[model samples]
Every structure is written in structure tokens, then in C-alpha cells.
Target: MSRSLKFALLITLRGFSWYIRHVTKSFLGRGQVPVIDSDAHVVETERTWEFIDGNDIRFKPVLASARSEPNNYRWLVDDKLRRRAMLSDIDHLRPVDRNTQTPEDAREMSDIQSRLNHMDQLGIDVQVLHNTLFIEQVADRIEVDVAVCKAWNRWLADIWSKGNGRFRWSCVLPLTSINDALDQMRFAKDNGAVAVCMRPIESTRTLPDIYFYPIYEEAERLNMAIAVHIANGNSAVCDVLRSPYDPGASFGMFRAMTAVSCHSYMVSELPQKFPLLRWGFIEASAQWGPWVAHEARRRYEASGKVFPDNPFAEFRVYVTCQNDDDLDYIVGYVGEDNLLIGTDYGHFDPSSEIDAISILKSRTDLSTSLINKIVDFNPRNFYAI
Candidate 1:
């Protein structure tokens, strides 16, 4: 067939297939894709600031762009600069409704009630919410980072209590001090946090760094999972995401690099050291599963090296996958129980093209039970929900 004809036929076939699926779902009364979105995001509003201590020169994250790099943001402690920068001619639409105009009026992420409404419309039963901007700003300020994490956790605890169990947050920790991070993890767990969010790739230190062992020991003690949500723009290796065409490309590359390193640690001494600890890598596509598993086996066979008994075990660690990832290959190597489905709802970045749960449900290779396992069961197991 000619190229133009082939394109036309492909479009026609896809449309026809979609129509058939739509009608079939309608007939079955399953039009809504029911899912517990394992990695959705929440935009922090003024509510996050409600509990922050004002006496200590406290910090709150704002989207500010430097005149030097007008397209990218430079997160700083000065809320004045953060706000003035936004008001002072930034590009694109502010992440708020134009008719409202008021910055606070457009805040969806900060308000748990408003966020729940969005979830209702999207048929999302649950969401594992991560911090929007604050996770990236705390570079070296130890005291400031600790206080901010505590305040945010306090605010989140209040919301979670009133929310009647709709939101689950990954509590941020100040890694500058091991003792302080442990204290925050315990505090967050006491306040009902699902997991402790941290950077998986420590650019300064390798995976087997001794400093991390204390935190892992504490997490295992508390039975709290460590969620390595992909850090963006201004990590150790990359100053900014720097992708003019696709920012998510840079984020994906970061996630992939971080995830592979994390897996290497998991397959080696880290998991063995803290045998009770559980780790999860989020926002990174899980298609890397097969490659990592392949490389892992290749090394073990080539070198006759020591290895874990069940190398593909899903109990200790988990990775989240997008709807379009290679499912068969992932399941083949990573095991279906180890796979999780998460749509980055409300995130401005590129994510799954369709409702992730629906895509899993429609997979020809996955049985109904396996689809349920990916959508609901795995996440529950991963997060201890």
C-alpha cells in the first residue's frame, strides 16, 4: 500500500476499534475506568502554608523563573521573589483559570476538597499524592529543610484526617542528617503518611553509602516504604531539565538512570542489609524491568557471581509503569505482582495517553484477574494500604 493510503487505513482501523470497544463497554456498563492511581500528584495551595511557622524565616515553594533562564524556574526561599517573578511577565498561562485571575483562586493542588472533585470526575478511587515543588528546593539547608518538612507533614495530617481517607502522601525527609530524617519519618508515619519520599539516585554518594543505612533501618523498623518519586530540574547531574521541546524527556532520563541504579542496589547489598525495608520507584516507566533483569542475569552468569535466590522477587521493591509500556516483557521479567499502574493526574508533564486502568483492562494478554492485580492489588501491597 502507498504511504498515504496506509496512514488512512491505520486511522480508520483505530477509530473502528475504539468505537467497538466503546460500545462494548457501554453495553457492559463499564464506561468508567476504576483505578487507584498509585502516582498522581497534588498541587499545593495556600493550605500547605497555613501551618508553617512564620517566626523562623520559613520557606514555601513558588514557581519562579530567572531572567537568565526565563523558561525554567529557580526555586528559592524568598516568597516575595517567587510571587513577583510569576506576576512579572512569565510565559504561558499560569496554572489557574484566567477568568479568576487571582492566583489563589486557581489553586487546585493545595485544596484537598477541590482535588477530590477532580478525582470523582476521572473515576479515580485513590491517589498517592507527592509534593509538587518543595521536594526539589531543599538542597543543603538542613534546619530549614527539616522545619519545612515537619510543617508540611502537620498540614497534610490535618487534611488526611478531614479527608476521611482519600489522600495518601509520600512524606519528604531532610537527608542532610540521618537522625533528623529518621525523626521526620517516624513523625510522618505517626501522622498517617503512606511512605517516605526521597531521591533514589544520590549523585554524591553511591547506593551502598553507610549514611543511608540508618534511614533504611528506621524505615524497616516502622514498616514504611521509601518512595523514590523522580526529582526534576536541578538535580545533582542536571542543573535544569533543559528540554525545550519535552521537559518530561529529561525527567524520564533522570528517572531511568536513578531507577537502574536503585535496582542495582536492590539486587545487591542494600536489600540484603535491610531485609525488612521496602522500596518503590515512581513516575519512571517500568519497561526498564526487562533490561535490568537481563543485565542482572548476564552479569551473574558471566562472572559466576553471588546473587539473590529469586532475583525477580516483587515483595521487597516495586516500580510503576505507564499504560503504553511493554506489558508482556515487563511481566515476563519483573513479574506481574511487582508491576504497578499510576497515572500522573494533575501533573503538567507528559504521561499515559489514556486512562491507565482502562489500558490495562483492555490488554489482550492480561487476564481480568491480572489486570485487577496491576490496578488495585499491587499498589495496596506496595504501599501497605
Candidate 2:
């Protein structure tokens, strides 16, 4: 055979081998236990933008190329860089096709049947979806942000409502205005939002502040869980609400915010204040719980300020983990009952895009029961689903 024919044959064999391997793994990953992904994000389609209704295309944040950079896209509003939206969901475990950018890229993130099929391939039983680009874009734009969030939530509900039971989602609250936030939240509950999502980074106000108390109260009353999914904190410039919308947080803020907020809630007796409230700090990983618990102990030793309850107690605290996190320490410090597993599906940069539970499911260091808790039972308990 000529060299060209040999090359063609080699490519065909490789393609066939990949298909066989993929099919086999997809079949094998269907687990007996349901895996609930506590924090999965979706790239919003133009369905979300439809609610904007002739707003200046420039001022309205939209996805655009990162100034000619290859394989990168950023959220830009009036030419100001907001955040890098995931341009692809290609799993790095395999060779990636970089030309996969399109609004249809969002179908894997937002479409009901597409996501369900992806979940089956990954061994995930259910995924709790959160908003992607817009959450950070609207962080500081106030009323403008409110409109964007309102549109996005409506679009989200319309799609997830059709998901049967496979897709559950939290709505993004209009955090800039109290009235707006409350109104949209009611709308969210009516539309079937299971929780409310906020970025863990310090917003115009830190989450534990009294300004957020009312939101927390309403969430508690509505039986809506609160989720603080991680964001870069670089994108937010919260202009509404109060005067000191702290702009101090950066990419490194999620871990610090998780520690600080939980500590504050415990120290200031927030768990008691909003006793029925539930919170999850997600995508920040689960490694910090022990350190924060130790600091709480240190402060207690130094100042004798005793918390009415352990902040790490199962009722008030939940944190999401990657397979690489020290699961043993997390369970020891925060309790296995409080853990949540987030595949971060479709978040291409750091997310495992495929088989989010395979690591824990296959871990020799963990017991089958502990694996089950992290992948299945714990998330259900956290979400009360």
C-alpha cells in the first residue's frame, strides 16, 4: 500500500478504537447509586439574551473573542473585560478539537436531553445547574444586572422545567436591589428553582453582612438553599446596594471567603440568626475546612468566644470537593454528611468534563460507603432532594 493509504488506515483504526473505548466506559459508568452534582454550570444561550430586548448590544454584556487570542473568549460589556467564559467543554483526557465553539456549545450545559445523556455517560445521576458568564457579568451593574439575571433565570427555568427530574437549578437573585432580589426570588420559586446562587467572592457586601440577612431570611422561608459557587471575583464591581462594595477580592478569594464567612457566621452567631438557612461554598474545593476549624479553636482559646454551635456541623455547612481534595481530612473536619461533589460540568478550564465520580468510586483509600455519601447521599441531604 502507498504511504497515503497507510495514513488513512491508521486514522480509521484510531477512530474506531476511540469509539469502542468510549462506548464501553459509558456503559460501565452507569452506577447503581445516583450521583448528584452539587455545582454544575451552564453557558447561557441567546434564550437568556432574548429578555434583553434591543438593549445596546455593547453595554449588554456578551461573549466575544479575547482580543484575537486563540481559543479564548471573554465576557465584555462596553469593551470592558468581564471574565473568561469557558469556550469549550472538551475533556483533556482525550485529544481535543479546538474548533468546538458555538452557542450550541451551551446545549451540553443547558439542554435537557443533551445534559442527561452526558450525565449517563459520566455516571452522574442528577446535576444541579448554576449560571455561568452572566453571574459574574451582572455582579456590579445593579439594575442592568437585574435585567440580565431576570432574563437568564426565566430562560433557565423554561429549560430545566422540561428536564423531568434529571436537571435541578438555582436561580441568580437580583442581589443589587432588595426589592428586586425579593421579587425575582419569588418568581424563581414559582418557576421551580431549588436554590439561589451567589459567587463566594465578596460582593458589594460580604455575604455575612446584615444587608444580606433579609435575603437569607427569605431564602430560608422559601425553602430555597443558598449556593456560593466560586467565581474569579475579578469580574464584579457591585455598584448598587451599599456604599462600600468591597472590590478587594480577586481570583484567590474563594478559599478565603469560605473560611472568613463561615467563621463570621459562627462568631457573630449567624447560624442561630438564620437557623434554618443552608449554605454551600462550591468549586473552592474542600481542603480548607480543617484549617478554618483549627482557627476557630485558636480564637476560642485566645478570646474565649464560644460559638453556640459548631459551624462545621452538618446542618449549617456544606462544601463541594474534587476527587483530588483530601477527602479524609474534609470528612474528619467537616463531617462526611456535609460534603458535596461538584463535577463542574462544561467548565472546561479546571472541570473534569467527564466521569466526575470515577475517582471516588474507584478510590482504594475510601470505603464504598464514604464514596456513596460524597457522590450520592450527601448532596441529596444538602439539597433536601
Candidate 3:
């Protein structure tokens, strides 16, 4: 066949296959492609800290309600306010239903079956839960950090036991202490965790800093991907960058920091150093990727370094894209294998597209093979599921 005829035939075959699958799923309810919700979240409750043991019990985060902000509940950790417990139910703009609209049991994973049923309704096969609390700085004190992370991991492990392999999670580590972080990573790997969650801007150290070398090494050794979620660990930077008028920092600054981390990691030789390790820039839309790659190349040349033509592929790096992102444009930079998609399930943010799977499937602009990779193949391989 001629090249043009071959391409036309490929498109026709894919369209026919999609039509068959759609009809079967609509009528028989069994032909839909199983989807992995790669960026789901679980709301941390008072019970999330119940696993804290021994003297560490003193460091258990206390849930407190703000009198000034009656709608906000937060965690007081090491005498400092941690991230808000949850988005306010009465917030006018975002609204409570954005995140907590799900049944309380399902939102908190207190009832595993409830969450599973909710996922079933959404057509999600598995949900890789990320931490809502640890997305920001937890505590300045290493002891407190260790206590909360350990408890959180233990709590997730228990939840995973009840989830029947439908729930996977990324483990949080005490970045202040490398030895302790390694210990926690080992435990998490054994207990159904497929990745280690780290903030993109972790305090004074960035992802390429020597401080994270041990983490990258251990993550590679354990076959766990380093999940650089859209978060800032430095409260000072967040305060300075987040404007008074801005409703939230996550929408703007945190995502920029994550893109910066992606650029830094790609420009630097970190990925090459930890070749076996997979790096995922989660919840940061893949829109900035090509820009970062273009900028990374400029920086590489400025420093007399040769940039890889496809850094995302050359390095084992992946990025989670939003439904609104220019998929055709981003796919050109990231290639099909390095691009993944998620619902940002459980959070009401700009990245949250509760129907991301269906949304991607509906985009006829993208080839069916590419859509399958974003919704299934890429995420499964990235998370090592």
C-alpha cells in the first residue's frame, strides 16, 4: 500500500474497533478498557494518625478547627499549621462537592467497599492514591515528619489490604532524614506502594540536589518511581510567591515549581545517573513540558552540555497531563510512552477532571493508540503496576 493509503487504513481500522468497543460496553458493559486513576487522593482524617507508636505518639498531628475560618479544618503539626484538612464545604467558587462530594466513607477510605463502588461508577479499575496532607510542608522537626509519614504509610497499608488490589499508593518520606526515609521506602515497597511521593520544591533542596541522591538511588533499587507531585515543601517560598489575592497556590506557583523540577532534572544528568529509576511529574499539566524541554536545551548548550533530543524518553521520565492540555502538541515533545493522564480524583483543583478517562477517549483529534497509552499502557508501566 502507498504511505497515504496505509495511514488511511490505520485510521479506519481504529475507528471501527472503537465503535465496536463502544457498542459492546454500552450494551454488554464489559468491553471498556480498564483505566488506572493514576492520581487519586485520600483525605487524611484523625484516624490517619492512629498508627503512631511509642514516644512518637506525642508527635501525632492534632486536627483542629479554625475559629476565624469556621469552614476550615487543619492539622497542627509540631505546633505549626499543616495543610488544611480539606477544602471548605461552603467555598463559593470551588465548592465542597468538588472533592468531598463523594460519600464520607469513600472520601476517607474508611469503608473500602464504598470507595470501590464509587470507582466502579466512574469506570476506574484502580486508583493510585496520593497524600493530600503531605503535599505541603508537614513539619520542620524531623521527629514529627518521621512520625506522621510512618503513621500515614501504615494507615495506607491497612487500606490497601482492604482495597483488594484496586488501590495503590505513593509513599511519603521524611526528607529531613535520609536513613529514616530509606527505611520508610522499604516498608512502603513491601506494602503495595509503587512510588515515593516528593514535593517538586522540597525545602532548600531541589530534585537534582545531592540531598535527594540517596532517594533516587533507593527508589531505583526498589523499582519505585519518584513521584514529583505539584507541591512546595518550603512554606516561605509558598508564602512569598502566593499572592494575597490569589485563592490558592497550587493552581499557579506549585505547578510552575514542578515544571521547573522537570526542566532541572532533564537539563542535569540526574536521570542518566539513575537510569533505572522512573520519574513522574504528577498533576502538573504536560503543557509546560515542551517549553521546559526547549528551555532545557538552551541551558544545556549554555553550559556546554548536549541535551537529549527527547529527554522525557531518553531519561525514564513521565508527566501527568490534564484533559484541557493540548494533547497533540504535548505528545510531540513527550512521545506517546512518556505521557500519562489522571483525574486528580478526590481533590477539587484545576487539574481535577473526574471524567478524564472518558474525556480522552472522546478526543477524536488524538489517535486511538495514543489515547490507549495515556489512559492505560503509559501509567501502568510508569507506576510499575
What TM-score goes with each of the models?
0.76, 0.77, 0.88
lDDT of 3 by residue, 218-294 (tens): 99888788899989998888888778887775566688889988888887778668767778999988999899989
Error of 1 at 278 (Å): 1.7
Highest TM-score against the true fold, candidate: 3
Give the clashing pairs for model 1. 43-109, 43-110, 45-110
- Which sections of candidate 2 miss by over 4 Å? 1-31, 53-59, 65-72, 88-111, 134-139, 232-251, 307-310, 351-353
Which candidate leads in lDDT?
3
How many Å off is the CA of 27 in candidate 2? 15
Candidates' C-alpha lDDT: 0.62, 0.64, 0.81
The better-scoring model by lDDT among 1 and 3 is 3
Error of 2 at 215 (Å): 0.4
Tell me how many residue pairs clash in candidate 1: 3
For model 1, what is the C-alpha lDDT against the true structure?
0.62
Clashes of each: 3, 1, 0
Off by over 4 Å in 1: 1-34, 58-74, 78-107, 134-137, 232-236, 240-253, 306-310, 352-354, 362-365
**How far does residue 79 in candidate 3 sit from its true spot (Å)?**
0.4
Report the backbone clash tally of model 3: 0
Report the alpha-carbon TM-score of model 1 versus the true structure: 0.76
RMSD of each: 11.6, 13.7, 6.7
**Candidate 2 C-alpha error for residue 159, in Å:** 1.6
